[model samples]
Target: MTQTPVSKAPVFGAPPRPASDVSAAVGLAGLAGLMVWVAICRAWPEIGAALNLPGPRERLAGSSAAVLALVFSGTPMVLWSLLVDKVHLRPSTGIDWSAPRPLRAVTDGAMTKLAGLWATWGLIAFVYCLARWYWRGPYVFAMDLLEQAAPLLFLGAIPYVLWLDRVLVEPRDGAWHFGAMLIGREAYDREQVWHHLRAWSVKGFFCAFMISILPGGFGAVVEADWSRLGADPVAWSNAAISAMFMIDVQIAMVGYLLTMKPLDAQIRTANPFLAGWVAALICYPPFVLMGGGGVLDYHQNTAEWTYWLAGHPALLWLWGGIMVVLTGIYAWATVAFGLRFSNLTWRGVVTNGPYAWTRHPAYLSKNLFWWLATLPFLVTTHSLVDAVRNTVILGIVSGVYFWRAKTEERHLLAADPKYRAYHAWMGENGPVTRRLAALENALVGRRRGAGEGVVREGGAGEESGQGDRHPAQ
Candidate 1:
């Protein structure tokens, strides 16, 4: 009797609805606002003098000014999301604005939530104090900024929490649960407390780094001599790349700072797995293992694309263009997140823009850019050993990123059914993901076939009494 073949259809439901939490127009609006502000800052020296403003004739390139740019960059997104997308009314916000509870009724829960939030901030501050890296180099700016904002944040939380609790469908959220655990006044879910800590940890860790690096790139782009770049391919490409980085950093910092439930941008869950944290933290400073002289440093004795392709004008132009495009894709990945971008957290499932083509476009483009731009295999020292070592080390670095992507998938797949559907859809339909899956399947088939052939040959030898065996047997 013949048996019927099982169906190979995906178990994951229909592809997630095309709707995304944040719209493309919302991000584009923020981009427009940021560009307008950047232009004004670049021309501020002249404009301030023209208006007889009380300041020196210099562009606003200070760290404080860059922080202000975060405001400019974020405000338009908030406005667009509210005015256009009406995200505040979304059911995901867990808000029922139609019938706000009496202030007295929610006052207790609000206080508990605030307690959890403040304690979390205090703990993060303690960690910052203990970490020596927070007080040195670029982190000094972050420290300074936080010091100034700490009081404001404490003062602001009271009203925000109180107001939010009145409309919250479930006021005893993760923060409230954490507060309950701390106060020992009410029953609380340990998992909720754990999730609360993880979310804040992601925000605290990434936000500081984002703020510390913000002013440098913003200043570079604001102070760039655009007139001189037109004739120099290297300068032109670098300028473009710098601008892209500025966009990414500025917009991403805003996302980290503004995870308000009212905006429908609250972190759903921080990546819960320890492996996820390990994979992510090692790529950032103070824990980065890929820095110069570090264990995973892959840039030792390497010559960059510009150096190797120096005399070839056409090739230099082509290579530079490729790098710039890759950098743009990386930036686009961040911008596509709108107000939902952050590391090791799920704000929402974004399925539009570059994300539609591939789930990990940013990681893919980033690793590719490093390979093409650094040319790690082509060492300046001209030693075969150095070349081989650099290439292998870089491969390991890429593997770390692959690890990160997988861990993120594990977290998201567990947290959201939408992500599961999107994952399955991408595996079956995404241009990049489908091709890569096919290649992987093909390789696995070849290996299995090769192993089976070897087993058959061994069996034949044993049957013919030619197989290796002990003489005693």
Candidate 2:
């Protein structure tokens, strides 16, 4: 798992969030400004008309737009400030300081390659759109494709730019170099970067898949005339919930794809637990794609969504609010990971954002929501014992997630000392661990009782009880 080291480097550095970079500044500022604009647009009508927004529907949309603006604009500046000011990373070059000619040529070559690829792709996309316009009535335009493709295109393009820079600077044996190519001053293993590239690509594709499906869902919501909010408020709330979840997914996918800095070395290898793999597989699409029975379907467990609760306005609002907050926290945790986000592996030990307060914010919030939403304790059967059994079965699913958390810790602890240190810190400082310890003791006591009962049921003699009893007894 050792990465190949880059040789012969001395390039000058530039800040990623330079004040002089007008285009970058404007782009980010524009996004933030647009959010403010949207907030004005949505809020103005309500303010001017004094419209009532009591239910979850309109309130959810308004809140989402406001939050998205902060996420899009604020996150980048914060991350940039951290990298530049806190990390204090500087750019360096491999070429000798005197080799100005080689540097110019290398830069020219890399730029030329990038320009050529982009132009070729642009031309092809344009032609495709043109053909579609002529042959099919009201065809999709280049702008439409660009709108959808921009974020993904950036994800792929940035990596290529970094890879090209690497290639130019650290040429293969006998490869030509124009001048010294600039890269991060810190030494990063070539193989690790390659792994990151592969990981990001895979994750990006998955994100793309998620992003692609969301528009259709939104389209369906829009067509349904959400403003009416007529018959079923639960349905409206569900749509809003789905929309918020989709937006969260979009942010995470986009951020994860974009955040790999060329010099940000992969700190550790991915060593996932078998339990994590199994638990994740049972829950996500891979299992369903493989035609495994949807053994862990949420819909099935959510039989707890009773007709009584659904009809009660107060209950609906309460449940809806809880669900929104839980999902929001889950999404926020992913956002906190920023570029280090990955599935089934500890990409990096994030101690910022939601991670600053709690280690498993996503898992904790999500499982709590599952328990509330499923209401397993309320589920019923003609046989009282059967009802309890069913509730226990549903409860076990959430328990599996607890096992996942432990497995994650073990895997991460093996990968880096940071995770081990993080675990120790959590043990000392985390609020949830104490509650868990108390619950564990309670469960242990109950289990001992059950085991003792089983021994009695098996017709063990008094002598057997003497052997099994506590030493004090």
Candidate 3:
């Protein structure tokens, strides 16, 4: 007898791919600006001498100069977004440039917004004053810089608000709602006010951290001894890694600072969940739980890849190359954000570059690099207990990142439908996610089959017992 042919399972079809919130051109523009600034910084000494400029005859690698680099990097991005991308014309910007409101009509709204904006800044400044950490170490540099620029920023806000209001289609944004509540002259959504506060809190907290760390990486990259590094794989890798971090920091700093509606780079919503706040804050500054001596410190008794791989030239080279690649992926993930990168905030949905492969490319690459480079399981102490403890601690640290990824996803899923679509697409089509999904399905299928077998056997036993008891009936 011929058996009926079995039908093949239908192929998995991915959901429609969502458009990346930030355009490729915008990222390229920012990258171009960053490269220009790097070139200028690296050659500044020679350029200064050639021009007979009255400054130090050395590369401008000071914190002040590094701070100034923000201008070089940010200006081009802004110009390109406005002139090339025409981002201001987008409906998402909440602007109607063609029908600008009369100055008198927008003045009252602008003034109220200014009040809210100023109050928010004042509150942030007060918090900065209260936080003792802001006065110490790297944060001192940030404090100094912000202190110097406070007056200018205050003055600049006036014209910026006034000009923006004239073109804004709906001038009553979160900030306006906040101002209305404070003034008590108009009705306002409490949720909108809270959103406004959360957005600024993210900016306030992250901008300082980004600015504080900028000079360290910027100087390392600017002053790296390329000639000496080429001969040593470890040194070369370190330099490359530092340069990548410098790029990430520079781009991220620009992102935090340039949260303008016109560029369509404003924070759409900060993560409202407390769990998200905890997950993100614990990774940063004063609250970081993974730093040395902290509860989650995983570096105890550990030797880096360099030490363990020592004396093996081939292995060292291969390992160093791997580390550099991981770091590059992490940096690329940040760059893909362009001006939208910020912690616990949904500026936009990024579905390009490293993100196209995995939803948490930065965290994945970063955690992998840490594991590979630290080699926590191979401790310097040579004690199994130490090795196990270190390994477990590092695993916990990785778990924290996973927690962060989930929290971020939770925020984005609720905030934007585009992100929901992107999430679905990633689950089906993403290189890493698709394989994970398939494995999960396989495991689940096996479990269901085992459960069914148990049920069938139990039912069969019940039938056999009943048949035996009813044999006479």
Candidate 4:
């Protein structure tokens, strides 16, 4: 039998395939994936439409992006794989150098991102207001108006910065790799993730404050707003937006567990907090970048904001509530499905908690959860504008994620051999079986042994843990 590289975290037992030879893999995968898609279209037009068929223009753009991405990323992965194959490169090869990630897209990423950390347009308005206030007791301006126009400016920055960073900086990154690569993130070590998480925690706090506090601060400062902060629709809307942002954070923290594999175990057992911090840190940087740009600017400036603002209370309030609830379910399933920690592969699920019943409660839960995530923004949105934005940002991204998951599922099914049986027992409803099994697991755990927890592993009277096997009769 062939042996795979021993990863720091336990995986669901991959067949020890070599890491993609970045360049060749991309060339192969892209050609293969496209050919497969073409055949699918020829064979199954219904499925093609179901995948949200893109227009000619969008298809061209996407295909170009995919090709460029394949080259940029595939080259590196291919190089690394060759290095491993030829030299047997060890995991310890990555430099441990600690450098600050300067927010400068072009500057060495080791420096702090001081210049572009805050939304420039909003900052200009804010700073201008502050300057006026210092000179004159207070000033008046439709600050929110400036915010409305900022999205276009912000969205434009992504491609530009990605280019600047990769071209000028020492780091060879992409959008997926901070933008240098159009696909897949290089896995970092446990310590690297921890430090990154610390950075993320600091930034997340600032972001939460920006979302929740900025509106209140602005409202209190405005002469009309000062008299009735709550009365102002924009102020109320801001509060709601901020609240939802935090709620989303909590949801994402748990939501990530759905995609986690077995290796996440080390995080759970060795250091959960650190693992969580890393996950949140990496996952949320995209939002932070958006925040720095005051992501909603484009919508606000172009009547889109006004339209959304006017309808936001109903749109966001109603749909946001539903999203929150579904997110809550996903969060619950995070633990219920044995999805928490480092899920490198399928082995993470076991006899414990939700695993006794359904195979992937979190999978379908996530399917619904992604839709819920979109609902909040949709509720506040009107027209095809909002629809298009959500389609690309949320829908497309989520769809890609699900597609990759199916691939991983296929790999797991092949690896475990018994996965089909387990899945059959669980049923396709996903959560239904897992929910019941989770309840039973809890009861069994409670009765079988005190608060120590239920028997998670397949072994009798023993909890399932990484590497723990089922007791032989």
lDDT of 2 by residue, 1-473 (tens): 64322211111241111011011232233334434544553454455556654543332233234334435544554455345433213222232223233444455445543453354445445554554332332222213434576678746764555454543334321111111112333334455444333343334334434433434433333334466664565675676666556545544444444443332312234333456556555554434321223444433323555354866887777787778787777766655544344555444455444443355777777777777766655544445555565466656666666665655555555554444444444333434433444355466563211221111232321110110001000
**lDDT tens readout by residue for model 4, 318-345:** 5555554544444333323221222322
Residue 267 shift from truth in candidate 3, angstroms: 1.2
Question: Distance (Å) between predicted and true CA of 232, model 1?
Answer: 0.9
lDDT tens string, model 1, 288-403?
Answer: 99998999999889978999999888887889999999899888888888888888898887766766666688888888998998898898889999999999998898888878
Q: Rank the models by lDDT, top first.
A: 1, 3, 2, 4
- Model 4 residue runs over 4 Å out of place are 1-317, 337-340, 350-393, 428-473
RMSD value for candidate 1: 10.6
Worst 10 residues of 1 by lDDT: 464-473
Top of the candidates by lDDT: 1
- Comparing 1 with 2 on lDDT, the higher-scoring candidate is 1
TM-score of candidate 1 to 2 decimals: 0.90
Candidate rank order under TM-score: 1, 3, 2, 4
- Candidate 3 Cα errors over 4 Å, as ranges: 1-16, 439-473
Candidate 4 lDDT score relative to the true structure = 0.33
Q: Write the per-residue lDDT of candidate 3 for residues 1-473, one digit (tens) a residue.
A: 64322211122465445667666566667778777877888899899989999978887677977887777767877887789768778777888889888889989999899889988999999999999999999999999989998999999999999999999888898999988988989999899999999999998999999989989998988888898987799999999999889888988899898888898988788888898789889988899999999999989988799999999989999999999999998888877777777778877777767666677778878889999999998987799998999899989888788777766666666566666656666665667655654564475563211221012221211000000000000
